[model samples]
Target: MAKRALSVLVSGYTFLEGLRWHEDRLWASDFYTGKVIAAGLDGRVTEMAQVPQQPSGLGWLPDGRLLISSMRDRKVLRREPDGTLAVHADLTALTGGHINDMVVDRAGRAYVGNFGFDLMSGAPFRTTGLVCVEPDGAARVVAEGLWFPNGSFITPDGRTLIVNETFGNRVSAFDILPGGNLGPRRDWASFGAMPDSDDIGTLMAAASIAPDGGALDAEGAVWVADAIGKRIVRVQQGGRILEQIDTGEQGIFAAALGGPRGTTLFMAAAPNFAEHERRATRLGQILMAEVDVPHAGLP
Candidate 1:
């Protein structure tokens, strides 16, 4: 297939992280602002809710409730329609690192990731892994030895779960059982390296590592945030780099399948953390774009 092009729809955000298309609006998390913002097709932004701790991932359950990952609190929360947040699951005991991103299945099972260690300070810590949270809130670690697991998604057929290991610079897959257990882990795709001529070195920066969030397109291509690269990469099922969508920003965090027909791709881009602290960029901006393909998996 020919490579699909990505056109920017919108920009300017403070460390955007998670992206979800609910109803007719596009919803996302602002990591630094601790708030969720909903964007309409007309480009209107509305405050959805405020999360006390930093928010990273977002999902919805079968019951129509919103699931939010409170990265700092080490817990998954159920946000009711009335604006109250309940403890969906506490993951601190199960995960050695901080929760990062997640994907919820049709049965309401949420597969989540962790930071693995202190990235900013370059501190050593135990390797992180993926955890499965049942609909009733019970949770367990299903895979380990991952280096900063970030964006993830379940295949449309519901047979495979793919997760991006940020620090490892690779995407991994797992066999999905009926009861929510992941098995037989293996590499799915790899983002080789920053151009050798660039000064960032072999590893991408904190926002890079295929960062915060991603979504699958109709052709089964994985559209990853590629945060550190300041772009989005479309990876096919066979591990091929199909296309790259540059957001024209330093800290591109997450992307989602949204817009009128679900073919439009919405990205959350922001200035670097240091730049944000210096008031050099707006805290939260929803960058918009339209892609050639539609979303493959559930929104």
Candidate 2:
């Protein structure tokens, strides 16, 4: 396979995640910087919102409002039409650990995921639940016992939702019920079998694939960032690798499809995902690579 070159669009960030292409700009959340930013293709950057609790995932509701995942505080933020950032839903009492990523459906329902265990504290592995925050701010556990549900996307038809189970080394799919609840799940792709131990260190070492954030293309294929492999791969149904881009030294945390004609693939690359290392140095970058398939799905 011929490794393609990546062009750096922007740098000098602590860590970038939760990328989305909307309103002719690439929107992202910087973890350590505690801000949500939008960047143009010309490398110009604009600070959109300041999240003191740290923002992770980014999405938009049907009414054109922005919903952000406040990671540490376990809340979902909403940018009102008047430009005020307020708590739309609080999950501090609902979730076990930090909130990470989310995808908002057409009906304005936000599906959110959490860390499940304290990664900073080095706690043992504990499965967590995926909750759906309704437009009215009501939340409920939709699914439980997920091994670290990270990046997620809803299919274009609005019927299926796919989420990256990082530690589980697989991607899971669920049917989006009419009332915003998730149906029984099926393994979309499994890179390797899961181990028996419920330890973070053991699971991390035993897994063969660490699928992180992902983006959906027009053809229903997903481009997923492999945290452990330090690369991005375009995968079809049943785990067929179509194309891959080796990120070289940088470990890609997230990926998004954007740019003119939706042919550009944006990657959130950094040395590592550790909070201490990422905050100590501003080495995070948004790298771009042109691909054949155009984007055609929700955030």
Model 2 regions more than 4 Å off: none
Steric clash pairs (candidate 2) = none
Query: Model 2, 1-299: lDDT tens per residue?
Result: 56677899999999999999999999999998898999999999999999999999989888899999999999999999887898999998879999999999889999999999898778888889899999978999998888899999999999999999889989899999889999998988888788898787798899877889989999999998998888988988788889989888999999999888999999999988988999999999999998989997788
Scored by lDDT, model 1 comes in at 0.75
Cα-based lDDT for every prediction: 0.75, 0.91
Q: Supply the global lDDT for candidate 2.
A: 0.91
Give the residue spans of candidate 1 off by over 4 A: 1-12, 192-202, 205-212, 273-283
Could you say which candidate leads in TM-score?
2
Q: What does candidate 1's lDDT look like per residue over 184-206, in tens digits? A: 78878765543422222335552
The best candidate by lDDT is: 2
